[model samples]
Target chain A: MTETELLDALKAALGADVLAAGGVGHDLWAQVAKGRVREALQLFKGTLGFNVLVDHTAADLLKWPGGHWAGVWDPCQATQGGEHERRTQTDGRFELTWRLMRLDEKSGLVEGRAALKCRVSDGEAGPPSVRDLWPCADWLEREVWDMFGVKPNNRPDLKRLLLYEEFKGHPLRKDYPIAKRQPLVAPLPAPEGRIAPEQLRPRVTDPGLVE
Target chain B: MTDERDPQTPGPGSGALTQGSGPPGVLTSRLDAAIGWARKYSIFQYPFVTACCGMEYMSVASGHYDMDRFGAGFPRFSPRQADVLMVVGTTSQKIAPILKRIYEQMMEPKWVVAFGVCTCTGGFYDDYATVQGIDTIIPVDLYIPGCPPRPENVLQGLMLLQEKIQRQGLHPKPGTLRPPIR
Candidate 1:
């Protein structure tokens, strides 16, 4: 299926959940309701055959303007509803994105490419863990958590992935200083099975020098 | 005491310059000079290669540049058997502690050569993740400052180290300023 057909199928299946949808070049993206991300992914995988989880990542939306629709035309201004739902997310601070791919089994080719995005408020928990859906999400989610401190519920191992254990804050956060360095610890003195200082060879081995 | 010098041996009490008897010339020299000469000519190097600078180190050891001509061709993989530590690359913050441990494990009287700009001052990697300079972890003898330093520069650095070894007194501190030998 083509990207447009995939978006149409999404609009048909998840009518109320897809807030805004459009194509960016050949690929397409759908702004999904924060709570409906897992449900949408399940639909894409279970029915539409978008089995390949291309990559899952997130970005800090700290730079985004409040209540301003970042689309081709303001979907909120065109909305007939009293108050557009997209205009009410003044508190939304992070944009979690998931790129998925549909692959043809017989010809071994890509059938479709689609992206799903959801805005998460600053204090809210991250989107549900997709480790069960795609095993690669295990580390990818952990990395997101490590860098952004966005906790994903039901995640078995949600600890720092790239930074050391003692690292204080998520370094990728906008508030985190770029040049800030963490305290480093030296290794323990004299590990087990290490050769004793005296047992090691003498420093000088020159024959001409008399001790 | 074994016939007070064998007939084949001829010299003035073992300290004289002999001619035409035992291989022509027999000249005596100070014990210090002999030791210095020997130590300078045979440098056992532990090349702690970690980054791109290792390519230049390879060329320096290769036949064209000929590090063997200066007695630094055989790079001892183990730190225990080495007299000189030739650190030849960028050192990241993650590897700094390990580098420190290696430096500590090496025997005393060892000299450390910071063999590239990265090892010397972290090169362009002046950030939180990369070590600013290896000297922050261990003492350095010679700093061969280049991105990966040319073969000629490395040879010159080797010559400087050799001179340093020659000038040093007994119980030689390889890189420090020791008092003049009496």
Candidate 2:
């Protein structure tokens, strides 16, 4: 249908779960409840034809000193004069931004995109996994867990994507120390069956040995 | 093939020695100079490329720069085949162990070149995620500092590795990764 109808469909289906909805031009966005994230994503994919999960990542807002964060979201919420007017984040330290776009059914060209955001504060068991809706969400969600320490519930293979397993804290978190380094797995010993270096280069000084 | 029979005693393999000035040089050069010279010039380098510096490495190795002139033209993808570990970019904490493992896998008398500033001292990525300097993990023979370094700088680093290669000699230490001498 039209751009307005898609967001309207989301609102009609999820009701109060659609906390706030707005768009400037075609950049439609909505703030949905954290618990209902999977349902909202399923709605976008199932009925709305928004098949592409463009991006899924989180921002740690602990030191955000927030206001308008780069998007022209809701003019009323825009704090003036650049003071430390911390924007309310639903009592969560982290916000997950999921951008979904749909392909035009006939032309196969992309028609529009929607930004679905939900805040997940610490001490909560993060948001529900949308990997069930989109397979790509599996790695994206794992990356979020890898970088921000926010694990999506029900993700089976929630392992590190970018960092090594021995990596300690999520470096993306605001409070994580900038210079702290966890000890590495001790440099591995040479693999078995490999010839020793000394054996590789035997000492030979008796000029007679060259014959 | 007697060293005692010596240079004065030239009754050998058509300079049968001459074919390689080589493979026989590999066996004969145990005399030191020829083997060291061969190893220095024929650097089968393992380009452990991980970041933007890779672009510079490719340019340096390409025809315009002619890394082949230095005898280090061939890039061995397997660490076992490579003697020079050209650590060509940022070695993050994640890749540090893998880098070390590759270094471990390499045959002895191997030389490591930290080919960029991020690899040298972690450069602008002085963050928790990047290894502060690869030297903190694997031993480095030369640190070529620059943000991804100019192709000229990379060549200079390669030349330095060649010099180090010439000096490490046939005498071997099993696993201790030593720093560059002066």
Q: Candidate 1 at residue B156, lDDT?
A: 89
Cα displacement (Å) at residue B16, model 2: 25
Interface RMSD of 1: 11.4
Model 2, which residues run further than 4 Å from truth?
A1-3, A66-89, A105-108, A185-211, B1-35, B167-182
lDDT of each: 0.72, 0.73
Candidate 1, residues A1-211, lDDT tens digits: the string is 6556777787787887788666543466688888878888888888888888988888886765544255337433454332333422335787788898888888998877888888787767877888788888888888888888777766645787776777788877776765566636442334245465359564324243122
TM-score of each: 0.70, 0.75
Best by TM-score: 2
Q: Residue by residue across A134-207, what tens digits does model 2's lDDT show?
A: 88988898899999988887764578888888788798887776546674645334434535535744232323
lDDT of 1 at A79: 47
Interface RMSD, prediction 2: 11.3
- Which tens-of-lDDT digit does each residue in B55-95 have in candidate 2? 98999999999899899899999998998888988877777
lDDT of 1 at A154: 65
Best by lDDT: 2
What TM-score results for chain B when candidate 2 is compared with the true chain B?
0.78
